[model samples]
Target: MDTGVPLSVAVSVVGKRQNPELVRVAGAGKEKCCYFFWQGRNSTVSEKGTSALMTVELDEERGAQVQVQQGKEPPCFLQCFNGGMIVHSGRREEEEENAQNEWRLYCVRGEVPVEGHLLEVACHCSSLRSRASMILLSVNRAIIYLWHGCKAQPHTRDVGRTAACRIKEQ
Candidate 1:
């Protein structure tokens, strides 16, 4: 939730912003929580696009090794923050040109931190819980779907719709 200066970051594609299967670099060490940080209608990467540059703000310094993964590939670290490092993400120009079907997931935040605001769990349909709400971007990049669990609150539904509309209008 803290989008402050990154501890480290995957700034942009090494070549061009033509790939959404595009950005994410992670280092190893004691595992900790990282947050997705980007600028748009809000911080979420739930918008339609061919390429996007997004980063995670790490809570601590980098680990020994580094790895990069591409879009909707099911990220290992939800957030990246490393004050001392700048990471790059990219692919062959052909790969970028051929890329398609990439999408993003954002879970509705609960009222408190202990409730867990996870981005990865949203990858699985089985992960949809009756107590939560979520926003999903269809792979075709033309539809924004708002999903609410059976037990989700009415207020959360409104918030999800608002957030979806905000991105749609942009």
Candidate 2:
């Protein structure tokens, strides 16, 4: 499948007490296919942290969506296509502080036919403040890809009098 074209993107962040979530949305039009690569990192004062990378494929014509959520309490949830979900737990904490720092990455590839098209992606990081102290979070980065069709190849030119020119030079 074609990787599609890349476009400019915008990033936003929202922080909440008791419940914290991160959301990202991107897509092409309904007439093509696209793909995306995502990466994420979580940092805190205690020296503990987490990181992940994911890739996704999207079909603009069929309206496909992929959702991923990672946290300490409820584990991680990965949803794709229609009613598909995958759950994973026991992610190794890099340091003592990492147990409180939660992070996840989402990458998608697909096509969108509309110029003003949009997609929604969200992440939530939650843990017991009693067991592990939640420190100041330094979450950053969002990469968006916009499909702009395929690229064209270079053209070649032929010389009609190559043989005559070659003999004269020799």
Against the reference, the lDDT scores of all candidates come to: 0.42, 0.22
Tell me the lDDT of model 1 at 107: 67
Q: Report the lDDT tens digits of candidate 2 across residue range 1-170.
A: 01111111222323333422222232221243222222112323222211111122233333322222222111111111211211212223433455454443221111211111112122333321222111122233222222211231111001112211222333
Where does model 1 exceed 4 Å of error? 1-101, 110-122
Q: Per-residue lDDT for 7-125 in model 1, tens only? A: 23333324434445543332222243333333222222333121122232233443222322222211223323111111112223434553563554566553322222324233568
RMSD, each candidate, Å?
Answer: 17.0, 24.9
**lDDT for 87 (candidate 1):** 19
